[model samples]
Target chain A: MKIGFIGTGKMGYPMAQNLLASGKELFIYNRTKEKADPLAAFGAKILGCPKEVAASSDVVITMLANDEALLEITAGSEGLIHGLHEEGIHLSMSTVSPKVIQEIQSMHAAKNQILVSAPVFGRPDAAARKELWIITAGPLEAVRKCHPIFQALGRGYSNFGEEPARANIVKILGNFLIMTVIEALSESFSLAQRAKILPQDFLSAINQALFRSPLYENYGQLIVKKAFSEPGFTLQLGFKDATMARDLVESYRVPMPYLDVVYWRFLSALNHGKAELDFAAISSEVFDSWEDHPPLK
Target chain B: MKIGFIGTGKMGYPMAQNLLASGKELFIYNRTKEKADPLAAFGAKILGCPKEVAASSDVVITMLANDEALLEITAGSEGLIHGLHEEGIHLSMSTVSPKVIQEIQSMHAAKNQILVSAPVFGRPDAAARKELWIITAGPLEAVRKCHPIFQALGRGYSNFGEEPARANIVKILGNFLIMTVIEALSESFSLAQRAKILPQDFLSAINQALFRSPLYENYGQLIVKKAFSEPGFTLQLGFKDATMARDLVESYRVPMPYLDVVYWRFLSALNHGKAELDFAAISSEVFDSWEDHPPLK
Candidate 1:
């Protein structure tokens, strides 16, 4: 089966390369065409646009940045909807909103095609290692047909059922959970610094004795050292995820009161011109906002 | 060394047993007295009051419930302070306020005695296994002298310098961080359930991928199952810790905006009569308070 891939940014580039390595005939596209040039070395064809990629492949996957990019590539003029043939499937691996996926699913349904929501859980590093978690949902037949494709891109897959937006919802909530953890680490590190305990000592103790997790170890070290200059995931994108989570929570009518704090911190980080820094930069914001250091009130 | 053990409750009982088994001459006291009875077989002498235990022993350890209990046992007219010798040191393992610990320290100083704050991190199960993390702070010589006692009672110890209240601050902040995590997990689980995904599935994926820690694994399962009963640590005590954290934050003049959310949720849990349940029961509160479930706004 032929596979077309779109949006070859940091995450998508490595993911598409893995798909090509798995012996799939791959057609790739990126807004900045140069981003897809590296994958051409392995005999993958670089297409010009999403529409062009869609026309030549039975299964087309889009791994764009946000809801806007996903929408433009899937539903805009010169988009995938104009080119995908009947019985074709458009698999989305972008972390976008459920609403966008729902809209795209309707657009695909109109053309007698399938749209599968299969947003993944992993950083670009995990993507390079082919260690992502493919959270998938759509028609059962479509998911089953794409199982081999999922295997090529990720370590494993969890099917969230037939409704395409279910996968998007899960992905959004998962990202929200991650931001909440980062905020927790930020606040604790801030408090540790204020209390005259080194953030390193506090993080070391908790990581060893209680929170023995990669999330803590990785983010804890980054936060303790205030190493946010290089972006693993930028603060701006982290803020976008936080905003989307707030929207989802509001739509669900759930009182996620703590999320308000996460949203505020992310926005503050961006406001302080930390848009290019790692999301863990929120720790510095947290530490700075403490009213006074030692002799508090 | 003659050791005085006060408050033989869930944590104190096992800790006292470990000390007794380590061949220390132990004098144990509990308000109800019966709770200390089990230690008698191991040659422990069950005394009538905190005063009696303190009068008979050189180094005393108190592991009561809260600030009030700690205050009464340490400073009330019939308390340990009135009974101890001039050079005696009181080691407090209960989770209480930095303010309360400082007050108790000053009271001990007035009597030419010493108080060492050495709160622990572990559940009753870990306490039984002697794997608790003992966090200590006091005079350097005093903490050094109690090294063997802490070793017998815990897997390891971290000394936070000579300020007796420093250990209390760290314990309070550590508990606050744990509550923040529980609240984050609850919010995510509530959202996952709303999205028609199983909390177990969401938890399992995150645990395997990012949060590879016992804190997430243990508490995530309990919250997912709504198995908050049988009290690993009760909602009531959790609320107390959150309240103390707020106090500490206010005293330190630092703003922990997220903790306001945690404080409110813990109070809500207690108000909903989950006072006797495990702290993970906050997940239930989070689920119940959702304005509507499937048909959100």
Candidate 2:
């Protein structure tokens, strides 16, 4: 099947490259154009707009930055909706709101086209290595048709059934869980530092006894070393995900007290102009407030 | 060396049995003498009181309910402090506050006896299997003397160096981390339920993609099945640990917003007469609050 990929940013660039490496015939588009230009070296056809990429392929995948970008590229006058043929499929891999994807699915259905929500769980490095875990939802036929595409870019995939928006809710809640972990680590590590316990030693003890997970070990190391200079996932994106979670839960009338704390931490970090740093940098907010408090040793 | 085991409760019973099975000469005591009477079957000597237990053994291990019990048993007129010989060691394994342990340590030092904080991580089942993870801090020589005891009762141990209270701090922080996870799972599972997603499916997906830890999987299963009848770790004890964490961090001026959320969850669960249920029952509070709201789709 002919495939089209859009949004050649940090996560998208590597994902699209993997599609080409898997020997898929690919058409690519990026608003900046320059970002998409590099994929041509890997035998991908560079298109001028989302509509052009849509016209050239049977299945189009959009991995844009946020809700607005996703909506504009998929439904604008020059969007994919204006160019794809009947029975054409649009696989959305963006971390946008569930409501937006549900609305976009209706728009595609009006033209006899399909939209599938398949947000991923991994960073840019995971994307580059084709190890992203994809969570998908849409019509069974549409999802099955895109399996080859999922296989080309991800290590494995979980289908959340046919509503299409269920996948987005799962993705948002998953990100919320991760942020809570980061917040918990920050608070405990800060307390440990104040008590004069070495952060590394504290991490080793707790991880060995309780967690025994790479998620905690990696994030713990990042916070311990204050390694926020390199961005695996930016603080801005983390804030965006947190905002989406807050909005979604509010609409559902579900009380997520833990999300509120991490949401505030992300907002405070963003306001301090640390949006470009890794989201693990949220720990700095915990450590920074301890300037006046000396160790208890 | 002769060993004394105090507080023959759910955890202490199996731990004492392991020491006896390891061929140690065991002296046992409990507030209710009936609890310690059973250990006599395994070649243990049932003692009259904490004082008699301490007087007969070179080292004593206390695993009790709360800080009050720990302080009362160690410092009262007929307490271990009044009878432990000079150079004897007291190994505390209860989940109590660092301040209480430090104060008791000073009292032990004045009497020419040693105190070592050696709190543990595991439920009763783990204790029964000798699979607990012990965290220790005290004088080097005192800790070395307790190695055979640790090996008899635990899978492994991590020493936090001198200052017996440091081990208690690590233990409290570790419990705090576990509670944060319980709260996170509670909120996310609540949201998933309202969104027409099965709790088991949500748990499986997140555990596979993100956590991959038995800690999350076991607790997630408990929360999903609403199986809070059997207490692995009771909600009441969870509140005690949370309260200690709150008091400890406040004393250090470290803000732990996430802990504040879970702390409230534990308190709410306890007030609702859920003190005897598993701590994962904190999820019941989230689901109970949702009775007024209907599920979407």
Candidate 3:
């Protein structure tokens, strides 16, 4: 099968590389085209646009930026569907909203193309490890057909049965948890430093107890070392997902009062123009919450 | 060495039992006399109050609730100091504020009483396994004196050195991380369920990846079951620690905006009078955030 990848940004680039490294017949396209060169060196055939990639591939996987980009690539007249074969599959791994996934699923179904929501959880490093946990939802038959691709890009995959949006929802929820860890670690660590708690002791203690997770360890290491210069995941996306989650809950009359506060924090970062930095910069925001600390890194 | 045990409630009782079973000469006291009986049967001396326990032991171990109860036994004329010898050492294992630990240190100094902040990490069950992680910060000599007792109550103890509040601060930060996980799990699990994502699959998928940790396995079970009945650490104390963290941050002039949201979820549980329930009851708060599906028990 010829595999085409859309969105060659941070995660997409490495994922595409892994697919090509797996010796699969792979094609790639990026809106900027510049992102295609790195993968081209990895022997991936860089195509012109979404439609071209979609037309030649059996499965086109998307790891786009956000809802707008996802909608753009999947919904236009010359979008992915314009080129997909009736038996083709569109596997979306982007952390998108359920509604968007549902819409994409509906349109793909109309064209006799199958849409599979296969959102994976991992940072760029984790993705590089082929260690992402893929939560798949959509047609089970479609998912079965794409098992080889899932194996190419990730370590493990779980079938969420059908309902592709359900996979996206889980992805969003995972993001929500990540943000919460980032925020909580930021606040608590900052508090500890201010109170003169030794960092070696602090990190070792939390990591051993209720924490003891790579996500917490990953975020805690960054916060403890005050490393936010080059971000693996930008603050803007963190803010974006939180806002998406907040909308998801509120639109359905679900009262995510806590998420409402998290959304505001994300907006606050956007307001302060820290959106382009690492989400660990939320640590700086947390530090600012205290009256005594100067600011975050 | 003679061991003094104070605050025999849920946690203290088990911890004291573990110590007494280890064959130490135990002197026990609790605000309520009835709590003293179980241990009293095992060759443990049930002292009437803080003063009595202090006068009779070389080392006094306290495992009270919040900073208030912790202080009540360690402060004032009728407190631990009234009976502590010039050479006595007080080992504090309660989850109290770094500030309070500092205050206790000051009070202990006047009586030449050594204060060791040894806040523990792990639930009551873990405590019984002697599987709890104990963090110690105080004089090296004082820690040496309490090493035997630490061995009895926990699998191992890590020394933080000299500044006792630093250990308390580490404990607070650890709790902060736990709360962050709780709140995040609550939000994501609830949202995922509404989006047709089977929260179990969502959690399993995430937990299998970066989200995997004993913290998730333990607390995630509570949030997933919506069974907040077990009160290892009540929502009330959860809120207290969060606020304690917030207070430290605000006092330090740090900005912890994520906590603003978590505090409210905790407040929601508190508002609904679920403060006495398990901290995982924050699940309801997350459930309340989404309105599409009614809710799952």
Candidate 4:
């Protein structure tokens, strides 16, 4: 099978590498040429633009950073829709909004192509291990047609049926849950620490109790250790997902007061010039009010 | 050990019933005499007032509803302190605030008695199964001394150390997390339903995904089925916990924005007359918003 992988950044590189190692004819395109250079060792064809890549592959997978990049890359001369074979599928696995996915679907349909959204849930480390949980929504036949590359890129797939954008919505909401956990833990711990309980002790009890969520355990570790330099997902993206979630809520008239509070926290972190840090770093703002308090014994 | 258990409501009844079935010298007290009647058949000494119950027992366990009931029963003329003996252990296992626990502890201490705070986590069903996860904090010796009773009342006990009031805070925070999950799930479902996705589908994804905290799964059933009548904890208490959690945050100089949002959601439900309904009934407000539009399909 001829496959084309685009935007080989953090998540995309490993995914594209996996596809290349599958012994399929892999054509790659990247906004930055350096990312595509490494795959040439595996006999992967490096296409300079989307049009060239689309002309040569049976499938074009978009693993861009966010909605903006995805839209930018698809709306102009170098876009994915103009590059794919007439019958090819664009398996989009980026974290994006449902409306954006619907737009891509509409555009792709106009071009007589298919856009299958398959946003993934896993950190960069998980992606490197091929341990990511991938969710797809599109035609069942198209999903089946692209199984080999999907299997190569991810551990497993959850098909939410033919409206592929629904998968993107689910993925963003899932990310929203993670960020919500971070914000709640940060605020609660600051509260507990003020009440003379150690933040670590509070986290330990919560992690050990029925509220044992991976999001809590992982982000709680970062908050406890105060590690915010690097992240599985950057603070910027975390804020973006929160905004997307809030947007969806606004459109639906479902009040996201929790996300609203969290949105401001994200904005604080963004305004504080820590957008490049881990999303868990938002906990720092939570602890700001207690900066002068004696540490809990 | 001669033990006194005050309050025999849904939680108290099962917890006290479990204690009595364990072959302890148990004295039971309830505002209503009917509740204490059934336990009397099982070797319990049913008492009329908190004084009689405390006077006849070496250790008094307050499991009453609300901080008010607990305060009154323990502070009334026939209250726990009114009859407490020197060196008697006043073990409070109710869900309440840390300040209240500290207040009661000081009052009991001045009376030459030792108070231990041992707030529990688990639903009525868990209480019935005797599988409650008890978060205990108090003097090490006191918690150790009360181990047999603790074991009898729940699956196990986790010693959170010598600060008895800390356990009350832990229990409160745990409830806070459960409430966050409820609110998050409620809002997410509202968004999903507006987006024309099935509530059942969205809930199943949450249950199966990393967001699958037992809190979500349990509340997901309530929200999924829209079964909000016949309160277990009651939305009023949910509101109180939210307010208490908010007070805890503000006291410590931390702003709990998300919790504040959820607090008022419960408050709005209260204002809308959902005081007696299940806290899950807050979903009704979210459901009501989508009554006319018929979410986009």
Candidate 5:
């Protein structure tokens, strides 16, 4: 099967490489052509636009940044919708809003094509290791055709049935859950520091006792050492994902108060010019917020 | 060493059983005398009051319900502070506020009796199996002397140094973190249900992909099944812990917005007559709040 890949950025670059390693006939495109050029060494054909890539391949996988970038490449004049053949599959792997994905799915349906939402969980390092967890939903036939592709890109995949938006909602909620952990850790660690407790010691005790989750341990260590200069997922992306969650809950008129708190923390992190730092850097906002407290003996 | 075990509730009973199993000379007490009667068959001496239990043993372990009960047993006329010998150690295992523990610590300190905060994590079953995680902070000599007792009650223990309140603060923060997960799961599951996604499927995917923590799996299962009748931890106790977290954050003047959200959820759960239900039943509040939303097709 021929697979066209778009948006060869940090996460996408490694994912696209794994596709080539799996011996699939691959075509690629990127907003910056140089990022796609590296794939040529692995026998991938670099195309000029999303439309051209879609026209040449049986399946096109998009791993874009956010909803805007995803929609631009899917519905733009030089978009995948303009050139993909009938029954072709557009597999979206971006962390995007469910509403937009539903809209895009209907547009694809109108053209006799399929849009499979398969957003993934894992950072770039996990992507490089092909250890990403993919959540997929779409027509069963289309999803079945993409099984080998999913195998090449992820450690495992869970299908949320045939509604494409289900996968996106699950992805958004998963990110929302992760952000909540970051915020919880930040607030508690801030209080711990004020109480003359070492942040590392507090994290050690809680992680060992309650969570036993790498998600908690990784974020806890990042917050403890104040390591924000390097980012697995940036504050900008975190803010985008948080906004997606906010949009989702608002659309359904369901109240998710925890999301509101995390959303504001991400916004505060962005306004303080830490957008390039790791999303876990939001702990800095939490720590800074408690500056007025007198240090304990 | 001779040990006194007070409270004899669900958690205290199993813990006291383990202490007796480890062959320490045990004295047991309970507000309702009948509750301590069963332990007498296991080589435990059923005592009349907290004072009698404390006076008979070298170490007294208190595992009461909340701050009020703990304070009543520690500082009241028939309290451990009055009956314990000059060098006796008071090991507190209840989930109470750091402020109350500090107050009790000072009272014990005046009489040269050591107060060690050693709050534990695990349900009644974990306590019964001697699999609880213990967090301890007190004077070095006192903590070391109680090492065998901690081993009898827990799988492992982490020491937080000489300040007894430090361990209490860590325990509060740990519980606060767990409550945040419950709130996050509740809100997301509510959204997933409204979107026609099965809560079990949503939980299975996220737990396998993101958390991989038993804490998430257990609570997720409880919220999914709406199984609150047999609570591992009651909603009333959950509310008390949430209140303690609120009090801690307020006293330190630190902003913990996430705690504010969980605090209100616990309050709503209690207000709706869910005090006897499992703490995970707070999800019911999330579901009920969204009742006005028209059912999805």
Candidate 6:
């Protein structure tokens, strides 16, 4: 069965290329058509929009940026929901609000089209390596049908029950966990630096002792070096996920005491002109300018 | 060189046992001597007090509970400092305040005795396994002299510098980071549980995805299971460390915005009668009572 891929942004571009390299029969579409052009040389058929891509393929995979992008591509006047064949599957591989996933699932259900939420964990680089962790939920049959596509795009996929939106909630919750870790590291680095202990030293101590994770090693170094210019994940998008998590918790009537702190740290990072930087830039929001303090150690 | 091991608490008991098992001549002391009796089988000699332990050994290791214990053991009438030999070294293996460490260092310096702050990271079980991470700071010569002792007691050690108190600061900061993580996990778990996502599910997703630290895995499981009865580190000691961090940041004029939040979480947990519970019990502070909500997916 032919597969159509949508949204060739940082994460999607590498992910889609990995599928192409795995020799999948592919069709592609993006709002900025040029982004999809690079994949065309690798035997991917480029399409004008989601509608054409859906009409041309058995399964259409979308890795759109956010809620509005996913909504527009799937439910807009000339969208995939209007053109997908009977029993055709739409595999959502983007991180979006669970509520939006539920709405989109209903839209697909009305026409007897299958929708599977298969959001992923990892940055763009991990996507390129096919090391991304894929999370899936929906009808078991549809998930099984899309197994080959998942294998090509990610290292593994975790199935979280039959509700497509459950995968979305897991993705949202996953990002919320990331932001919380970043905030914790930011606060810790600030405390370490202020105490005449190098931020890197404090990071090394804990990391060596117990926190032996790639998340700590990667973000801990970025935070210690104060290097936030490169945007693996922008602060703006990070803030969006935080807001979504806050909304999810509020709707459920659960209290997340530190989430507000995570949200505000991202908001404060944005306010300080860190929109284009990596979310690890939130460290700046938690710490002051280094020059203001005398040599501590 | 004869080694004196004081404060045979949960961590210290296992740690001292390991040292004695490694064939070191050990003189042990504790407020309640019964705690040290277990070490006698491994050729450890019981001493009357910190003063007697210091008098009988070339190097004294004090692994007390807090600043007050360290201060009382080193500066009180029957303290270690009074009995230490002219060139003897005091290897403090406790989590205490940097200010207190500095004061203790001064007391040792006045008596022509050397002091090295060599605080550790790990729970009681890790200490038993000799997997505890030891962090040190003081004169390089003293640190070098105590290298064999550090090797016997821990997996590895990181020396900060000649400033003895720097190690204490690192230990305090490490505990602060752990509390921050517990607070973050507590908040995130509440959001996930309320959102029909099980806390264990949220934990599995994050642990599998990014935050795959032992810190996240261990405490995440404990918080999810609501198993805070057994104290790896008590909520009271966690609060003391948080208070120490707050004081450190305040003294250094460094702003740790989320530290106050952590301090309050621990304070609130204490207020609700969780002083004896594990610090992961701070999760109880972030989550509402189980009766207030129905079972979530």
Question: Each candidate's lDDT (Cα)?
Answer: 0.86, 0.91, 0.80, 0.81, 0.91, 0.85
Q: Candidate 6: where is the Cα deviation over 4 Å?
A: A289-297, B289-291, B294-297
Show pairs that collide, candidate 4.
A54-A83, A137-A164, B51-B78, B137-B164
lDDT of 6 by residue, A102-191 (tens): 999999989999999999999999999988998899999999999999889877877887889888888887787777777778777776
Query: Looking at model 4 chain B, which ten-residue stretch has the lowest summed lDDT?
Result: B206-215
Over the stretch B1-297, how does candidate 3's per-residue lDDT look in tens digits? 999999888778888889988999999988888878878788899977899899999999999888888878888568888998997999999989888888889988977889999989888888878888888889999888888888898877777778888777777777767777776777667666665666676777788865678778888888887787868878888888888878766666655556666777887788898988988786687776554556443
**CA deviation > 4 Å runs, candidate 2:** A294-297, B295-297
Clash number for each model: 1, 0, 24, 4, 0, 0
Candidate 2 residue-wise lDDT, A1-297, digit = tens:
999898999999999999999999999989999988888999999988899999998999999889999999999989999989999999999999998998899999999999999999989998999989899999999999999998988878889999999999999999998998888898899899888899899999998898887788888999999999999999999999999998887788887888888887887898899999998988888788784667353
What does candidate 4's lDDT look like per residue over A41-130, in tens digits? 988889888878877878888888888888877766778777776778888888988888889899989988988888888887778777
What is the descending DockQ order?
5, 1, 2, 6, 3, 4
Estimated TM-score for each candidate = 0.91, 0.95, 0.88, 0.91, 0.95, 0.96
**What does DockQ give for each predicted structure?**
0.56, 0.55, 0.49, 0.38, 0.57, 0.52
Docking class of 1: medium
lDDT of 2 at A48: 87
Better of 1 and 6 by TM-score: 6
The candidate that wins on DockQ is 5
At residue B125, candidate 4 shows an lDDT of 80
The digit string of per-residue lDDT tens for model 6 on B15-93 reads 9988888889999989988888978888999988789999999999999999899999988889998888999999999
Worst 10 residues of 5 chain B by lDDT: B288-297
Kept native contacts, fraction for each prediction = 0.62, 0.69, 0.75, 0.45, 0.71, 0.62
- RMSD of every prediction: 2.8, 2.2, 3.7, 3.0, 2.2, 2.2
Which residue segments of model 3 deviate by more than 4 Å?
A32-34, A38-43, A75-78, A198-201, A288-297, B21-23, B31-34, B40-52, B66-72, B75-82, B97-100, B239-271, B285-297
Which residue pairs clash within candidate 6? Answer: none
Q: Cα lDDT for residue B218, model 6?
A: 90
- Per-residue lDDT, model 3, residue A18, is 86
